[model samples]
Target: MSADVVAGWGGGEAATASGKKTLWWRDAPSARLAALGVVAFLAYLGGTWAFPLLRYYRTPLLDLGKLLDHGVRGGLLYTAAAVVCLACYGLALRIASRSGARLGVILVFALLFSATLFFSYPWGAADLFDYAVIGKVLGQYELNPYVVTGVELAGEPWVDYAPWSDTTSAYGPLWTALAGAVSRLAGKGLLANLLAFKGVALAFHWLDILLIALCLRETRPDRVAAGVLFYAWNPLVLVETLANGHNDNIMLAGMLLAVWLALRGRMLAAMLPLAGAVLTKFWGGLLFPLIIAAGLREQPRSLWRRLAYLAVAALLFGGALALGWAPFWAEGQGAWAGFRLQLFTTSWPLVARLALERWLEPARAMALAQGLALGATAAYALARAVRVRRAELTEASYGLIFFYLAFGCAWFQPWYLIWLVGLAAASWDRERLGRAALFSALGLLSYLLYHFVWFGWGLDHFSIDGFRALAMAATVLPPGALWLARGCMANR
Candidate 1:
């Protein structure tokens, strides 16, 4: 109504608003990083998809000559992909000090696009044939996959490439049911399991990124975009969940949704998804104690109420688990197979074998090793929570996550990192993300090495020790040095 108001809206105040943005946003490091993050992520997805397809298939179309050529070509592509993931990571960090959310968005779209293209490819879908085996066991013959192995149905060209095809999933019974249905629907056709299982994994992986972003937003609105970048563009998640084909995606999505619900004070709504998650991955059981601890924050509720609520939820999960797994219990003879000596999916099992051989008595070796490893892990988790109970940072709870992920003596797979990727991203600081990103990329080596180990070339698998050593140095050294500069402020 006033001339001054009109002037302010049309000219003078508008100028002030525009100037303020140039000063804070354009020059703002975080904003720049956020924008770049989105671009880099999409680029990573694109660059990765641009490479060779790693699917397992027995195409009558390709003979030994073709096989050799494809292998050589695939090798180069994977290497280039690794390089691309790393380069983008560097760019992300350079811009991270400017714009985390923008960077994250870039990274997310890139990685997702990369994964999408990879799966959609004819060759890329080959690696997923093993799932078809499971489907055949369930769909065609009505036999339980837990009771069978891909090796049993090994007539296909694709099964040759699914390194873990001979191995059973150790997945929750219900997951097998779903895989079987896909196989049945595809019906003894070529690449049926591959197409179906990959489709499921693809759906879940997308859901995982979206849910993780939502959880981060709900709990720490400041870090939402960054969390999405970390999970989506993350090399480990890409290789394992998207490429190698892991089922952890669905399980983790459920877990993130549960966290979101609980954080929003809808604890009751959280329980179903949490229980379902546990059924998908037994590791979800760890949330019981953490949730219990979180509930203790309110005055007058006390630890007893916390434990009681946890018990209720545990019972809730336990009941669902019993029902879900009851049908497959008799079929899961190898259910707990391959679950020995795993530690952070690092080199723990290797270390354990060497250590046990030197000192422990053979009669007592296995039991003692398992006990000590499991006990120490649990103790560390409890200790960490107690120490950080007063810390203002919500990400501090990651101590428990890191500990659990590190304890087992099984072989490490890359996408397993997705479990904690969200936490790391939500709390990501100006420190270089390149190292962790490198570790994520090297995880792809597991695919190549897995083939070597399975066909009786465990010796050859370790031949990459030279590369492993280099990768370790590259992934850890820079970050370690950066920590010294800031006194490692993550806790603060």
Candidate 2:
């Protein structure tokens, strides 16, 4: 694709005639469209506030409970909320594309949306409860979270809400340590602890936004708003980061900082945050080889500079990894034991096992599938980085990161898409952005399984079997259709 299409500017007329495009907030029609997006965002918040669906079964918020008491109507409100988020996301993209929106205005609106959603009740995912329970295990009981399962904390009051009774911590040491620190600060109060964790997630959320903005402004100054809003105003990013409080954003903050530093020509300094990202979540570690390739992609004619860059990157990243792993090392196991455990045990291997069950044992099938996917994605990424010039290095990295998350990872979660949000911002590819929006809209259906099948919080069990199929279709079909259509278009 040409730069125009990749930068999401082909359909919209270029504004070079005026020396530079007018910022969208300064334009009347685009500003009005942004106002409408704000209204749509408010509608989303209203739906969330009115019908909080994921309230803990043990400690129900009465107002939210009363709202959910309406059965199917409450479920409909949750769906409506997802739709509103989708609408706002689409509108923001249009405003940015057509009116040349300013990054500052888009950021202010994003921060506003994030703050509003942050305070709203945690509505759909139950991951936050697990985060709290694990943090409590570490902070209050002083146990090694890596070794102690929530089952060991069976007697603890907070464990009542944590679902992973027999499951060890699946996150990285840095994440666990940070969660423990937050747990200590919040003490034993459940609400206070939840808020504290959310605050940390929110801070990283903003940090991810800032890094994305900086990276794009440095690389593609003209497409700043498109890239920034692609990430900052992404509905999936907002919902997952602010409301769900997933640690994926924390991982991305480190990854983005590393990539942003690299963009600024500070290749050595980039390795520190890259290592931090690895410690935050091992997924970030996968980018190390790619970053090395990009660093070498620069100074292609100068072998010594390339070798020096690689050595420094290796030292900085490796040292940081060793330091971050010190806690796990002290416990007599590799810090990455959690990743190994999750690989063998979790539903992350479901797709692989399901596809190859007849040909191989479940374990073998899963291992083979994951290995192939990850290896192929990594090899492709390395080749791209080796070929691309220094200027295109970041986008190449972002594209590979998006591919790795979409296909390389064992399990797919809605929040996992947040990893792509920053990359999408950097690339500003219309097709990529469209598919992301589609995925965000469809991924919301996962909540239906929560509401209807798992808990039946708002709906009766009248057509429970049918509801499961409906939920599956809602969650999976849009992306499949999108891929199919795109393939056909490419062929034609």
Candidate 3:
């Protein structure tokens, strides 16, 4: 055998020849920083357990604005810590490929990161307010939130001021209904029930975090520790979903869990979470198709059984839509049609409006444009999926992330990009010339600039045009890193 093959097998041979030894630290500055980064990040997340919801109450336990404003404060802290925490996660990953017994080091980082995410509180983003508005309709007026907009629900005590809430979001009504259930349980003059909704989102987010851990464990057991940092510590996730209190985090958490289960040959079990995710946001349903493709990878009774799971999952999704409009389907076609209109439009719904307006008389063109976008993106994804190795789940996941965001009409809120950081981080190969380093630096910088401007956090709107400046960094970093990756891939 060649000398290289012998060296590659050294670790296994050494363990048999000698014995395993514990490693408490990595030698490099990057590894030391990775360890410190994990600590600062955990403390940051753990800090949120004491998050003062009462600060926002106009009265004690009722000042809603202050509570949300505090979330903005947390964002700055996040930008600082995410840089270090994620850096370690990325750099250590490359090192581990050449080392041994570093799983504990990685696991420590992951644990702290996930713990931090668990404690973080979402602020008063428009979507969170929308959840409250819908909850109030069910709680206060004894009416269906699906039938009314936030404007109509404005007279209620729980509903907050957000112009966007007047419209139905493409997010299905089941999540709203679930929020309504929380309102019913809380029976509040305070925003306690709205908080109950956040608690539920938090639980699901953590559950999803575990799901990600388990998935990484399956394909890359040693790297599971690093995987934790990527998925858990990401700032886009922190500010957008947790601090901003958006439902997409929980929705995605559910989707990722389902993806994990399906990949592990538990298609039947994956169905419920996938359905829950879809009910939370229409986008969650994308996994059903993804699962179908994944199932096609192997053929047998097990794979055929997935076909049954997919059928049941689809029926469940349609049933969720029906729950919102069962009787209304026959009596209120106009309202139902309006509800259907929401299925396609998002944050920048203007493009969808124009494309369908007067062109195909609204309805037909709307369906066509939406279908075309979906179909085109799906084609890109399936094509990319062709490269997925049995071992590299991260690459497959990141491909989905890029496809989902890039193709959608400009309707994205910044938080929509959070999930990509984890997938990308997991996929990083240090041999690929600091690809993880580039991603860690740029993904975070863009997220920081984007959120600060969007929130007016110590800066006015377009105050510094910071995002544009940050974009310059993203542009330069990738092409520059490409050569490094090329050299590594070629040399390897």
Candidate 4:
């Protein structure tokens, strides 16, 4: 590679003052940073190979069952690998910021990390099997996944693996259709279907990286490499989107594309992808008013022309939503299944509900928690919408998502962190980026808490409330304490 390209690969200047071109590898800081990237990649690869979830599947290459027969030990090993990878990520980011890394190096690492993790089983979640069952319901069985529970296809090989076989699909219609297409393409093999969904996630993961880079180039050119590294090297993002094969990456791709399109002044064109995002996952809908307001602000000042522009944008957004939902609506028979997912609370919200149950009836306590979450989210959204500017759109979106994930989300998972990290990548706000990184790292511990401590170690046998208390402490305290400390420091 040329010196320019090599320089972009985390290397410093390649030419000496005497007009002599030095080898790129000769630069100490760049070589060290690049080495850190490699370490991070290897750590992730090791974690994937050692993942306890692989024990469920039989593979000749590695007898994962034998290796991970002990749940506690296996969980510890996997957690250690994750911690090492996260540490490397932090060091790499710090070094890259000071030494000036480039996109070429970041992209190389992203591809390597993704490819390695792609082969590893999604140890943190069984959501992939659920996707396969849903896909089969739509593709092979010719049934609407949202309307039909996987239990109806219990005899199918894929259905045997899904944990939620009795429940209808909670995914949006757009995702259901895509999953169905992948399932049809993969045919009757269960593994084939799993890999096919993962493949789609992999494609969108790359798209997310590219779109983030493109959006940053427009809004924060100076921070492009840092932004890419923030999202690309995040362990939570890599594991969740690639290994676990969650559809959130696809949702994020749509959101990022919409942001990019808007940044390019194609206000009307932006609505399509934004709509696709909402159809993929309802969280994307939160950005609608903010995006629409920003778009409207960019229109011609003439009253008639602005009104016409508004009408066209609405029609375009509504039309896209209608098209995506039409095939699976089934006269709204089971169309609301996806929204019902929010009724099942977890994380901090669950803790809140349990505490409230001491005073109120169980149902009422849950309702109060859910209602407060909704109200808080709505208040924040309205306050943000009034002040959000075109330039502040990405940061605004990040704040909104962060708010919902922190408070409003009734069912939060580690994979949901992808939404925050994805948008934060395009933003120049270091504090938000730091918060995203912190959450991504801590989020992985949820798996440890849920899998190893609660279930694996049989802590649930003692007291479920105790386990919830532990979860609340583990997931919420660190960030909460940090935010408090930062505020106190700022006051001084």
Q: lDDT value for candidate 3?
A: 0.52
RMSD to the true structure for each prediction, in A, is 7.3, 5.6, 7.8, 3.6
lDDT (tens digit, per residue) of candidate 4 on 375-427: 88889898888887787889888888887887677777778889999999887
Best of the candidates, lDDT = 4
Which tens-of-lDDT digit does each residue in 1-492 have in candidate 1? 121221121121111223342222343444455455455555555544443344434442322224335354555554565566656655654443233334323443555554564553332223355556666677777776666667776475445555556766556666777877887787766655555676787788778767765665555555554455566666666656665566777777767776666677655556678777777766665554555455455325576776777677667766877888777776436435434333222344334544675787743555565566667767765665454432222354344554444444234455666666655554454332343444455554444433323223334444343334333333333433444445556657
Query: Can you tell me which runs of candidate 2 are displaced by over 4 Å?
Result: 1-26, 51-72, 102-104, 300-305, 330-349, 453-492
lDDT of each: 0.53, 0.68, 0.52, 0.77
Q: Give per-model TM-scores.
A: 0.72, 0.82, 0.66, 0.89
Q: How many backbone clashes does candidate 1 have?
A: 47
Per-residue alpha-carbon lDDT of model 3 for 1-492, expressed as tens digits? 122211221221222212443223422422464555556565555446545344443332221234334356655665555565555445554444444333334445445554454434444244555566677676666775556665765455444444356664345556766776787887765456546666776666566556666776666555554455455545455545555566776677767777677667765566677777766776666556556555445445585566765676567655655665452233342564455544532222334444466567766766666666667667766775565543444456665655555444334444565555544544544432244345435544554444543454544444232334334344333633464467589898
Q: Between prediction 2 and prediction 4, which has the larger TM-score?
A: 4
**Regions of candidate 1 where Cα sits further than 4 Å from its true position:** 1-56, 59-80, 93-97, 100-108, 120-127, 150-168, 296-299, 302-308, 331-346, 361-367, 385-397, 406-409, 426-438, 441-492
> Model 4 — which ten-residue stretch has the worst lDDT?
58-67
Compared with the true structure, model 2 gives a TM-score of: 0.82
**Where is the poorest 10-residue window by lDDT in model 3?**
5-14
Provide the lDDT at 255 for model 4: 90
Candidate 2 overall Cα lDDT vs. reference?
0.68
* lDDT score for residue 171 of model 4: 70
Q: What does candidate 2's lDDT look like per residue over 268-313, in tens digits?
A: 7889988888888778876676667667766557878778777877
